[model samples]
Target: MGVADQINWVDAACWNGTAFDGGWNTRLATNQDVLEPATGQALWRVGVASAADMTAAIERAHAAQVAWAATPPRERAAVMLKAAALFEQHFDELALMIARETGGIIPKGHHEVRESVVLCQLAAAMPMQSQGQVLPSTPGRLSIARRVPHGVVGVISPFNFPLILSLRSVAPALALGNAVVLKPDVRTPASGGFILARVFQEAGLPAGVLQVLPGNAEAGEALVTDPRVPMIAFTGSPGVGRRIGELAGRHLKKVSLELGGANNLIILEDADLDAAASAAAFGAWFHQGQVCMASNRVLVHASVVEGLKARLVGKATHLPVGDGASGQVALGPMIDAKQLARFDALVQETVQQGATLEAGGTFEGLCYKPTVLSGVKPGMRSFDDEPFGPLVNLVTFDTDEEAVSLANNSQGGLSSAVISRDVGRAMAIGEQLNAGMVHINDQTVNDDCTNPFGGPGLGGNGSSVGGPADIDEYTRWKWITVKASVPQFPF
Candidate 1:
């Protein structure tokens, strides 16, 4: 059997103004190679929905949403529960597949799967809490307001955290009675497909209720522009997100963007150097810092800067970097040559600009060394740009005020963290930070199913997409009034 047959990918898009035929492609449609990042070799052929396919998906999903909205909320949640069970049963297999596609370290892949399972359960419980309000009314009339589904949601997910990001949106949308036309990043189709499409299919969701169309930018553009898709949930880089938001705006569609970060990890003078160093090492190098919420910039108090630097460099140099498929690798190769090249260029540029390369700045194949730079300043490119790799730019500040200034200096504000022994003191400093999600003695990479996620300014458009608050983005409210007696109006 072909890879498409094995994966059961949706092939031709039905754009002849009719219904989709459920066809699978004989071979990969696009010329793009689906490569294993560590080896830079083709893993498997991929072919999913095209632009026309996405258009058909939108129409079909719109049709499906009407019935889904009529289904009891508890019944809808049941399907989500079943899907979550399927995801749990196949957790290890799914994690391995994700590692293959995105060069995610094995532990990181497992972490994503576990988090996805929690999110699925959270989505399952959403329907029970999706309640309408009975408002106060006059004696002659009854007034009420209820939340209703947006019909269909267009989900555009990123390469990193492929399963968690895509399913996190898909589950909540479905729970609230909306269908989803998910366009996952083309580079990691299997990661999205296995966990989302296949698991949900096995869980017996209604046909066309959830369609995973894995293709390039054209497919994404089609999803964004489709007339029937009323709401869009996207997670990616800021530049692409801005463009997507612009197009969605032109079409008058609701779009939520969870863009990446140039986040900060602040170590106050009161922080324990050992604990701070461990957090810094993991925050910067985990999955080679491909995480959207990774701590790229570290602001250390001048009083403890030397001690923190010594511990951090000591910890970073000990991390083993290689292919994740190999035994127990602490760091993994970047997703592709393009990302590795970008990482190399930026690290080199920062070093040339006079930042001390204290620990690492070397690579073998796609694996870049975990690097630490000591002397990054306010205007340095490394301080401003989100490298999105295994590199940390260290900047020292004299006082608490200076550290807060250094932390809030960036345009991006997706994630921020403050390390201090005093909880009262750290949270106060956290309040001063400009990012959306603040961490007290925690890594910037932290997340949970119950907490709000996303950022402000350059990070994103300030839309939070997690927990109960996410329902606001996927559903809208409508007011209904019934008059018990005929209205007496003078015109």
Candidate 2:
């Protein structure tokens, strides 16, 4: 049987008041097929659920969350741990599906799945780690603050890194005792919804505690606007994020949004050219440069500009571009046809604005070659816009002040990387950059599970969704105090 016959497109897992009961509609349409450039064969057809069904599921989840939140944090952590183990056991399958559905290379897809599992494990350990402080107040009176979960959290995830991002929100929410109603992006729902549902079920979580409603913007908007859903965690475009924020604000709902970014990479004169070039190539071309944190703009010192440009061009050109399912392929196609058009327009606009195309400016089917542009001015669309493709714009600077100024010129403050042999100089330069996270002598892909990670300014709302500190973002703190001696005042 073909993939379409074997897989269910509209697979719904909902909490119907008392229990989880929903059927998988395999015949559902993705509206199009993801075709391989070489063979022109269909890889998958992702489907979406209706908005009405998703709204009902969110209501059901909210009803069940009241009881689930009453459970102790330690018990909830245990369930997360079990789910983590199940995810690890089926990592290969999950990875394969993610690659097929999202057009990410196999190795990258596997890495995302591994990170998702690690996120679950970290979330499992969050209950004990989510500690509050004791206030230094009056003597003989004890005052403490405790963190509590938001009732029912609605998680809206993106297409890129479907499994990891979805699990990132769901695991933390679950660990904090918040029942989750997840809405995976319509483009790659199966990769996240299918694996997560299977893992949660295998871990023996109660049906209503976790539910997946895979659908498009209508379903996502419905889930977010519902009053019962008190918190929303969204990862997507800035325009959509702004709308979500406005809606949540009107309804008095708490929201954490990780939006789009045009990240910059700064390479100083004292930097190691070989290492910087390799890091730049990875940051610009890895996963087809679809990541929100990907270094779309590069500022290199004029002294080493020629050498760095040569190295980057060579490295980017050699990367194998093909279908993600092919294990040898280093770069994959853009997420969809619309994204390809957008990327093409950005490149063309930059060229028209007088930027010189250095390596590539061609497209075959949905595959856009790793493209590099030089002589790009600061205000061009390519320099200012978010190119969600394998494209990098390079600019040269003479002094550290100029480099910092150019880097901070944009509105995005998601992430930045500085490559230098001198650790002290790198650290000093890193301090001057206005990004939320910085990497010295390395790329910006080093996201450890033990450290807080999030974008800044227009890129993010200063909310960390991973690491030991992430639990704080998912919960609210309340203070309690008791009188030392029942006030000796007579009535």
Candidate 3:
């Protein structure tokens, strides 16, 4: 059946051009069916926007950027403040919708919704707090640098953490006075894209100020290639991010990408075994281990490896898994069948080689049990490669240097964690690991609004998308000079 024929689609389908159903059924000729990963139910479908539709959307965003940029920063901040409240007011509805669309458990879905409110509030306050500086100049002349928005910004958000991930960038871009064209993941158009559109549009934001295009890669590519969009913000795999970065660089357009990471967690001899195990469990298994900054490998001291394994495996064995939308499971199903197959294949192949399948690592339907593997070595794929699933490989080290080497061995450096009895020692070890965000006694998946969230190497390029620093990413500095008298020049 065509997506237009689906009944639930009327409630969940993402908006097209700010209109309900947004004339997509008539203009868009192609459609992609969205499946509920846990239940295999046909939830809704997304339209593959034609080139004409994409062009029209970009043009509208471009036109809106002019007046929106001219509006005072305080007024823009007010709009964002209201948007934050809207998100809070509709938190329950959005959370349940997110759980259905993205397969996130109720608690995680709630976190996504609640945190988004804070993200918007924090971003709203940034324009007022962040200001340009004055530079020293000659007498009777004043030199100043002022920040200005880069006009229209195209945001390509991912499916995982749909609400927080998309809004984290959108809220900041809008707060900094840039009109945003959000291209949410096709897999999660309703909760990820359209809900945000509704919140902002209803909050009294002018028409065309925020547009949502719920399509696939074609839409994202069009947004990037369009001259109307001066900035591109994306969150996804590193390979895609690299290509986008190269293209944006060629076009002289501003871009920021929060890409993939194969992070690590180090457990010292003095570390508490139970505490370390709990942190590891939450980091590697939460959200089905889809977090980009999750630890792909755990480096533990040889003296305490056995004890930590006992505790971790026990937790993994008893945890329930499946049906995130309606059931209270410890870990939800994988995003889709393809993701499950990829994750299963990696674990199977690693076990076939030399690794021991300790506790879980089996799949039933689209859901997979939390898996633990030991005896993973350097050559094995599970050692360094990030599966972005509920899997963790354990490797032991004798000294702190070996631990540090194991941690920094990955090509990507998004985040890492150090667990130890000594805070001073943990801080010392954290300094040595090559990661963008390092946790002293916690897990690798850290997303604090106040901290700048990004990484080095394969992780990302350019500026980050969080904290007040984001003002610098969505806007550029321009120098203005005023003189009481004409400056004397040697002519």
User: What are the models' TM-scores?
Assistant: 0.93, 0.90, 0.94
Write candidate 2's Cα lDDT for 235-341 as tens digits.
88888988999999999988888886767788888888888888888888888888888888888999998999999889768888888767878888888788889
Cα lDDT of all candidates, in order?
0.80, 0.77, 0.81
List, in order, the clash count of every candidate structure: 0, 0, 0
lDDT for each residue of candidate 1 in 1-491, tens digit (9 for 90 to 100): 22223322322131112222222322333444578888877766556556776777787788888988888878888988898887788777667777878897877788878887888798888888936888998787888898889999999888888988888798899888998888778788767653577677667678778776676788889989888988999898888998999999999999899887579999989888899988988888888988888899988988898998898788778888888856578888888888889888888898888899998889999988888999999777788788899888899999888888888887767899999889998999999888989999988988887888888976788888897577887899999999867777897
Question: Judged by lDDT against the true structure, how good is candidate 3?
Answer: 0.81
- Pitting candidate 2 against candidate 3, the one with the higher lDDT is 3
How far does residue 292 in candidate 3 sit from its true spot (Å)? 0.8
After superposition, the stretches of candidate 2 with alpha carbons farther than 4 Å from their true spots are 1-47, 130-142, 482-491
Candidate with top lDDT is 3
